[model samples]
Target chain A: MSTMAFLKRSPWILHYDASSCNGCDIEVLACLTPLYDVERFGIINTGNPKHADILMITGGINELNRAVVRNLYEQMPEPKVVVAIGICAATGGIFRECYNIAGGVDKIIPVDVYVPGCAARPEMIIDGVVTALSILEEKRAKMTGAAQIKDDARQAAGETT
Target chain B: MTVNEEQTTIGVALEDLTREVKALQTDGYRLVQIGCTDTGGAYEVNYSFDRGYQYRNLRLTVGPETEVPSISDIYWGAFVYENEMHDLFGIPVNGINIDFKGTFIKTAEKYPFSVTRRGGDQCRNA
Candidate 1:
């Protein structure tokens, strides 16, 4: 299913607050406000992981939220993009040395874009989401290309038979 | 706007913890917070209470392996902190109303805040 056209028009995003101090989460919400208007980029914030094409995560993964984060990532369909917002999600920030923190989101799942800030600014978060949109398109293109290659190989085998 | 906040700390024996907490409850003091500190060989547990503008802390210093009685019976909401103390500091809290049994704040290491960690490896050289 080549949903690249649809994804470009409206890519759904799921925002997960792993262990953030609400600083980054507030900034993410700010992006949605009229001042930033993140939705202008054809991005819609979603609640269900299954419906999400982009996983925007704030804060570093911890023991408790590790499994939850992994499960959410797995539930997202292929050609998904992960955006690690803020210093915490990128490098565990100040909580890296803390006992519970398991470090960046990339430790558990693959991250495509990283927005670096203590509490990432609204503009930065919007930029990260826009960057994730391009990555998501790239992943979709790869998925379709892989399918095309497999189909071509099958067709060649049939012709030989 | 500045307000005068009076604070006092009273050392309470482990055995008398329940009695003192119960007295504070009867006196209509609201349970403010429960905090634990890893003080070398011992764990200092402080239970703070607030009434009007006055704040009082019941401090209990017990051995690392000592079992601390749960104040949840009096404050009811104290189970949250009691479970945290048990999970984070390795302090065995007895008779908690809702006990998670060391699963409260799941950490990478068991009792990570404890001075003597379970494996005794993290801060040995630090």
Candidate 2:
């Protein structure tokens, strides 16, 4: 009914692949397939990070790509959610033994939801995204209150001056 | 030629398994690990399941210079692993993306560990 509710329900998402084996990357695309139909749930994959409400990351964070991944996370707008898909993103699966891999994605960004699997199943990824939306809604509510408090503080400061 | 009960586990020749892997249609066994240990100077290559869940480890022995058949056509993942082995051990896998000159070693020279006349003379001079 409300504009805020509509916006919260249909938040745009962006997919980022740090350096995956193409297994998890393909499974992420499977979620958007006609069989699963993630778009029906109001989850749209946006090309630009500025319009994204959630960042779905797939891959084990490596030393080389750590900075690039962090920069992308910073570029996203506030009240954003992060979803780490696949075992590599959650805990660095087979590549964990490799010296170059920097471990899990959470070490670089604040992960809201983690979908664990070598290459997370399509159904599970959809579930994780939906779960992230709920968390984002709660965060949005808190941020709205925080913004109102900041505005009130500014008004009071103007009067005192 | 005949199977012996006492030497069953110890000498169950890997040739039998390799034949089975080659016979497969869609999925095939792929060599995963290949390297030489400092203990006995023996080279070992371990082939495991390339596709499906149920698969067993198959071990094979070859000389340090012997060229092994490539399973890149069956399992695409083998390309990277084979390249890594070539970089570390200098073992060549035939039919592989041979352009994998060297990976982490950062050199285009032939087998760094191999002893040549120049290396021997340098050692003698030293």
Candidate 3:
């Protein structure tokens, strides 16, 4: 399949609000609204973990939600992309000094894209999602090539034997 | 009045800060921090900031009996602050929707500051 086709078919994004003040969460919803129109790009929010290709996480991972966040990350299939949304997710924002908070989301899970803003503007979120899509596309290409190369190597070995 | 001008004259009385805030909102002033401090005899209620990050501290003295107007409607951040202030000092902030069910202190009994002095001390008895 063409790279464009590969990108278009990838439908799933899981949005997890770890411990944010609901600012970034609202902005994520705004992206889905008619104004930003993220749906046109084939980016969709998924409820089930198994179906998701991208994980869009908002808020700084606090002590209460850290384990749950990590578990959700582990549940996602390989080649999955994690996008950390807002300043809280990227650097813990104003809540950074609080004892209850565990710094940023990256400390809990590996992040593929970091969207910076106290409550990140919808435009920046879209940019981050697009970046995640690009990263996903690259990974898919590498995986496909690796599988084809492995199959070819096996076929050659079989013929020799 | 814009707080960005270093110091804008806020003509309202300390107790009238809440009313002034309501008026300011009509003229466009976003509420920031609703904090308090214990001033020996009374608790000083402070409503801070004008808009965005620019801050202006307006304080009102409440001596246990006074009920400070809640700014929850103005700034959503004040909900937690009001609850925190209630938990620390037994000051009742009027018109706050959410139950200030103690975020800091667990019990309902009045203990404004730390439990420094306990009645019938074991140390004294010993």
| Global lDDT of each candidate | 0.87, 0.70, 0.73
Per-prediction DockQ comes to 0.77, 0.05, 0.04
Best by TM-score: 1
Evaluate residue A105 in candidate 3 and report its C-alpha lDDT on the 0 to 100 scale.
Answer: 93
> Model 1, range A66-103, lDDT digits (tens) per residue?
99999999999888999999999999999899877889
Kindly report the docking quality category of candidate 3.
incorrect
Clashing pairs in 1: none
> Residues A1-161, candidate 2, lDDT per residue (tens digit)?
25688787688989999767889889988887799878887778888998999999998887557888899899998889999999889888888777567788998999999998887999899889889989999999898889889989999999999
Error of 1 at A26 (Å): 1.5
- Global lDDT for candidate 1? 0.87
The residue-level lDDT of candidate 2 at B78 comes to 66
Off by over 4 Å in 1: A1-3, B1-3, B119-126
Who wins the lDDT comparison?
1
Better of 1 and 3 by DockQ: 1
lDDT of 1 by residue, B7-123 (tens): 999999999999999999999999999999878888899999999979999999999778787888888999999888877777788889998876667777877778777743232
The local lDDT score (0 to 100) that residue B79 gets in candidate 2 is 73
